[model samples]
Target: MKQFNTTLMAAMAMAIGLSGAPLAQATTPDNQLVIATSLAQVLSVDPQQGTEPKTQEILAGVYDRLVYSDDAANNTIKPQLAETWEIDNSGITFHLRQAAFASGNQVTARDVAFSLTRLLKLNQSASAYYKSAGYNAQNIDSLVKVIDEKTFRIELTDKVTAEDLLYRLAMGISSIVDSVEVERHVDHDDYGNAWLRTHVAGSGPYTLRRWVPNETVILETNNRFWGDAPAMKRVIMRHVPESQTARLMLERGDVDIANALTAPDVKSFVGNQAFRVEQVKIGGFYVLAMNAGRKPLDNPLVREAIAYGIDYEGITGTILGPYGRQRNVPVPEDWAGAIANPDWSFQPEKAKKLLAQAGYPDGFSLTLKTIAQPPRVDIATALQANLAQIGIRIEIKQGNGADIVSAHRARDFDLLLPQATAIMPNALGAMNDFVTNPDNRLAAKNAGNFVWRSAWDIPELNALRNQASSERDAGKRAELLTTLQEKFVAAKPAVLPMFESFFPIVLQKSLQGYHTNLWSLNRLEHVTKTK
Candidate 1:
C-alpha cells in the first residue's frame, strides 16, 4: 500500500499545475496530450483482473477486443479484431482480420482462446463478465475453441445467448492480450497475472512508457502498431484527484483534459470560447433501496409508501438541475429495451394510505444511509423531508463512498442511496441486480449487485430476464423488459430511483474526435488539441 504524504502530493501537484504553474499557451502540441484526473479505482492493466473506470480508461488504448460500439453513439457494436462474424451451428464464429501485436507477431485464434480461458481459470473480477455469459471453469475449456489461426468459436449454453456474448465481449473484460509475450512472464501458473497487472502486452495503439502508480501514467504511441498511429504521439495521464486542482491544471496549458469537473465549473465552461466541455448521460442512475430481508421494509406496502413519499423533481430539478434529469426505471432512458416513463411517480397521498394499510398508522423509524458526498447529502435531505409527512422518522448516516459500497454488498443498511446502472447498455445486464436470490441465480456473477443484501428472489423474473436477452425481436424483448420493471416497481424492494445523473470532462476547444465511450476507454486516436 502506497501512502501519498502531504509533501509528495504537493510536489506532484506543482509538476501538474495546482501549485502556481503557468497557464496554457494559445495552442496545444499535436505530439502531446496531457490529462489530469482522479486516481482510478483500480490501476491494474491486466484484462483478467481489473474492474475500475480508470482501469478501462487507460487500458482501452492498450488492448483490442473482438467488437466495439460502432462509435460514441454506443447503441450498436461493430467488429474490431474479427472483421466478420456469424452465428453457426448453435454457436458464434468470428473470422479474424490479419491483426498484429505491437511486437509485430500476427494475432491468431489460439491467442483469443487463451485469453478467454485465462479469465475463466483465474476467476478474478474480470472473469465475472464471461462467467455471466455462461462460461465457467467447468465448461469454458470446451466452449471456447479455435478453428484455425484466424477463426474462433464460442459455444453457448441455453442459459447464455449469442447477443449476451457479443455485448460482454465489447467491454474491457474481453481485452485481448498477446499470448506469446504473456507466456514469457508467466509465474507459477499465475499466467503473468502479477506482471500483466502493471505492464502492457496488447496490440493496441499505445504502449505504456511509465506508470508511477497514484501519480502518473505516461503512454507513447506504438510506431509499430498494425493500424494508423494515434494522432497524439504521447499522452500523459497525471493524477490530480482534487476537482479544484484538476481544474487549475486544465485552465493552464499543463494538461489537455480534466475529468470529473464540479457541476458548477462544467456549467461555467459551456459558452466559453477557449474551452469545451462534454457532459453525457451515463447509466450511473441515483436511487434508494430498502432492505427487503429485514424488518418493516420486508413488506411491499412499506416499500411502496417510502417510494411514493420521495420527491423526484425536488432532487433532480433542484440539487442536480444542471447535471441530471429524472429517471423512472433502472435501465438508462436511451438504451435498447429501456422502459421509459413508467406507471410510477411521486404520490404523497398514496404513500400515507399504504403506510396505514401496512398496519403502521404511524410510520416506522429506520435509518437512511448515504455517502458523505455533497450531492448525496442534498438528495437524502430532500428525501428526509418528503418522508416526514408520512410519519417516517429518517436518520441519516453518512460514510465514505467505498465503505458505503461495501455495506451495500453486505446488506448492512436499512435504507441506502446508491447508484445503479447496467454495466453496459444491455437489458439483461441491468436486471442482474434484483432478480437473484437462490432459485434463479445465474447472473449473480455480474458485479455491483449492491441491493442483493435483501435476498430478493423471483423465479419468474429471472426467467423473464434470461428470455429477454435471447429474444431476437427487439419489440418483444422491449415488452418483456417492461413487464420485468413493472413487477419490480410493484414489489417495492428497492430504494426508489430519483434521477439519472452525469459527470463532465473538460477539454480544449481544439481537441477534436472525442466522445464519451462510457463502458470502455476514452479513445484518443483522432484527438488533437486544435489551435
Candidate 2:
C-alpha cells in the first residue's frame, strides 16, 4: 500500500489552498469541504422518495428527527429533537428538547405534530405510528391527539408492539418540522407540500443557505445548534455528474471529498498518497424489480426461472471486480433481519429447466429499463449475457433517472434495476416498503398505478412481518426473519438482491472527524482542518 504521512499531505494541501494558484485550489477554503456526486436532483425531502444520498445530506442538515440511528456509535438510536421518551401503559410520551429553530421560533410538541401530519399527507413510509397501527396519512389525522405543548398521544386502531412503534419513529421521515411554516403554504386539501420542498425551516445543525438547482447547494453552520457546534464552517455539495471530472478534481486538490466513485476510478487513488479514502457499506440492495402483474411474470415458474438465471457470483467476480458482493437477502449483514440461506444460490440448470416448464425453451426478448449509471449498465450487460446462455433475450433501454422512474411507475418495461431503500433497520421495514406498502410507487402495483399485480401473497408472510415488527425478543425475531427470507427466496418477487457497495469518501488529508453509520448517515460535524 503506497501511503504518505497524513500530516505532510494536509500541510501541502493547505499551502495550495492559501496560495490560490488555480480555480479549484482557491475555491476550496481551509474550512470548507467540497464533495462531488453524480446524483441528479429528485428534490422532495418527503422520505417516501428520498433515495438519493445528495437529498439525504440536505435533509440531514435541515431536519432533526426525535431519534437518529447513530451509526458512528454502534448503530444506536441517539436522542436528537426529542432528547428522550417514556412509555407507559397508555402510550409513548416524548420529552421535547429546547432547540433553536432556523426561523428563531421555539421547538415544541406542536412542531412534531405538524411534521407527522405533513408526513402522513405525503404518505411517507418512515411514519412509525402509521405503519405500526397499519394506518395511512388519513389514519394519522384521526389518531394523533396533542396532550400538551410537549406531549402527544397515538391511540392505535389495533394493538401495536412498543418496539415496532419506536423503530418506525427512528426513520428519517419522522423528523420534526415547524407547524406554523407548514400551514403557511399548505392548503386544506393538497397531495403535496410544494412550499416546504424548496424552502426549509427546521431545527437542525445547519441551515440551507442556497440551492442553485443543478449546479451546487451551499449550507452554513447553525451557530445556536442544540448540540456541539460543527468544526467546519460550511459544506458545499457540488453536482458534478461525471465520474472522470470528479476524479480529476480530487487529483488536482480541487475537491476535498467525492462519493459514488466507479470501481475502476477508485484505482486511481488506491495508491495515491495525497488523500484518504474511507469506504462505508451503505444499507441498500440492488434489485431487478419485475412487473409481476404482467403476463410472463404472472407465472410463478417464469419468475423462478429469471431468479435462477442470474449468475450473482459471476457478476460480482467479473463485472463488479472488488467493489461488490453477491447478496442473497435484501438487508445487510449488520442489520436485524439478514438471513443465512444457502438454498438461494445460483443454479443455471434449474433456471433453464424452469424456463422450459414455463413453455419457453428459447427465451423471448423483454425490455430491461435502467438509468445511465455505470454500475447498473454493467449489471445489465452481464445479466443480458448470462440470461442468453439460458435462452433469455434481454433488450436494454437506458434513460435518465427521472425518465426511468416515470417508466417504472408507468410499468412501461418488463424489468427495472433500481435499488431498495430501508426506512429503518429491520427487515420488516424493507419488506413493508417494497412489498406491503400500497402507496409505494415501486411496489406490487401494475407500474406506478394502484393496480396490485405482483405474483406474491401470503398470510404467513404478512403475519411474520407484523410479528417481527412488535416482537421484543431478539432470538425470536431473528428466527422469524430467517423464515421470512425463505418465503421471499422461494417466491422470487424481485430479482436476486445484491450486496450494497461501500461508498468511499476521498478527501484531502487535512480534514478529520468525518463519521458514517450503518444506515449510511454521513455527519459533517467534528470535521476540522488541522493544517
Candidate 3:
C-alpha cells in the first residue's frame, strides 16, 4: 500500500510549505483550512455558467444569493438577500434585506434588477442558465418589476410556479452585483468584476485573495459580511484531480478536506482513523443520448428499443456502487414531481427483437462521446458493455470536461454520455432545460447538428407539464405529477440509469460545524477547528 504524505497530498505543496515560514507568526492554528479537490483549474468564478461542483464550492464562499437553501432543514429556501415577500394577484414581491453588500456598497433592489436584467440581455456564456431556470419566455419579459429601491416584483407573463423564479435566484447568475460595476461591464458580457473571475468582491463569509489556476486558490474571511465571519481566517484549495491523490492527501493530513472521492475510495477513507467521509444523493443523473436526426436513430422504434436494451441494475450496481439508486424514468424520485415508470424494464431480448423489426437484423455501429473524467468513463464503459449484449458496437470518444461539453454542443458524436445536476429544490428547472428546450436536449450535444426529435408527443404529457407549471395548489401539482409520470414512461424522453451518485466530502475528524446543501456549497461559514 502507498503511504500518504503532505508533499504529495496538495498540489500547492511548494507554496504551502514555503509560505508557511513567513506567515507562521501571524497565523493561529485554528485560522487556516485547506481543501483538496478533483478539479484541474478554477473554470470560472462567475455564477452565470459555473455549474461544476468546484465552482459552486468556491462561489459559496465568495457569493450570496437572494434566498439560500438550508441543506440541514430539507433544503428550505431561507432569507439571504430578501427579508420577506408576498405573492398577490399582481405578482411575487420581495422585501430586500437592508444590510447586504457586494464589495462596499449596500445591496439594493437596483442590483437585483441589474442582475436579473443582465441575465436576459447579456447573452453571455451563462445564457444556458435561462433554459435551466425555466425563464424560457424570451428576454424574461415577465421576470421582474422593481417596486422601489428596497422592493421588487416578478410578474409572470403566463401563469407559472414560484419554483421557477426561486430556482433562478438560487443559480449563480442570481448573485447580485453592484449596479455601477454591472454597468461598467455591460458591454462585456463577461464583466461584473472581471477581476472577480480570478478574484472576488461579494459579501459572503469569505473573499478571494489569490487564484493560481491548476495550483491553489486562497480565500480570507470576509470582514464586511452581514452575517458572522467564517471560523477559519483563510482557506487554501488545491486542485488535485486524481482521486487516489486526494485520498492520500486526506490520509496524510496535508489537506483538511477532499471532495468527490469515488465509491471504492470512500471505503478506504472509512477504514482510516484520521478522516471522516460525508455523502448526499443529489439530483444529478447520467444518460446515454442517441442522435434523433441521423439514420438508425431517427426512428422512434429504434430509440425505444435502445432505451429498453440496457441493464440499469447492473450499471448502477457495478459502476455506481451500493449507494446508487436505479432510476426507471428521467426524473429522480427525490424531486417534487418525479414520475416513476416501472414498465421500462431492462430487456436485452426485447431490444434485439425491436432492432430486427426496425430493419437491422444486426445492430449498427456508433460512437460514444464522453468526458475523460472517471465518473463519465465509468458510465461510458458500463454503457458499452451493456449495449454490446444487444449487438450494438460503440466506439468510445473521450476528452476533458469542457471539451466534452463543447463537443456535445457541436453535435460531434452519435451517442454521448452527458450528466446534469438539475437545479434541485426545483424540478421545474429539469422540465424547462431538458424536456422542453431544444438547445439543451441531448441530440443537440452531438456536433453533427442532430436535433432531439420529440416524436413521442403526447397532448396529455404536455398538458400535465403545463398544469404542473401553472397550478398554485400543491395537491393539484402532485396530481399533475402522477399524470405526467404515467405518460412519460409511455413516451420515454430519456433513460435514467441511476439515481444521483452521492457527492462525497472527506474531512479531518476534528473539523466541526461542517454542512452540505443539495443545491449550494457545503456551509463552511460556521466550521471550527475542534482540536
The C-alpha RMSD in Å for every predicted model, in order, reads 6.9, 4.5, 6.4
Residue 425's C-alpha lDDT in candidate 2? Answer: 57
Every candidate's lDDT: 0.72, 0.66, 0.65
Candidate 2 local lDDT, 1-531, one digit each (tens): 112123322322333445666443433787777888755644565443354556777777777877777766655677777777877655677877778687778788877777777666665323433654565666777767677876766654443555556655666566677676666676555433666666677778777787776678887888767878886678888878777888888777678887756667765565455677666655567777777657677678887888778788878776664455777676676566677644544688888899889998777777888887657888999888878888878999888777887776566668888766665556665555344433333443423221222333444655666676656677887787778777866766644466555555666666677776544446676778766
lDDT of 3 by residue, 160-243 (tens): 656565655666667776666545554355556464455455668888888877678888887788887777888888877787
Error of 1 at 151 (Å): 1.7
Candidate 2 lDDT for residue 95: 79
TM-score computed on alpha carbons, candidate 1: 0.82
Q: Model 1, residue 51: displacement in angstroms?
A: 3.0
Q: Residue by residue across 1-531, what tens digits does model 1's lDDT show?
A: 011111211111123347776643533477788888755344577977776566777888888898886545555878788899998547899999887888777889998999889888877646655654567878988988999999999897766667777777877878888999999999999989989989988888888898987789888887767677788998888877566777766766667787755566555555556666666555666778787767788888888788778777777766775557787676667767676655556788888999999998888888988866546777888888888988899999987545666676667888888765455566567665555433323355433334445545556665676676567677887788889887766666555666776656777766777766656466777776566
List TM-scores for all candidates, in order.
Answer: 0.82, 0.86, 0.84
The per-prediction tally of clashing pairs is 5, 3, 7
Q: How does residue 375 of candidate 1 score in lDDT?
A: 60
Worst 10 residues of 2 by lDDT: 1-10
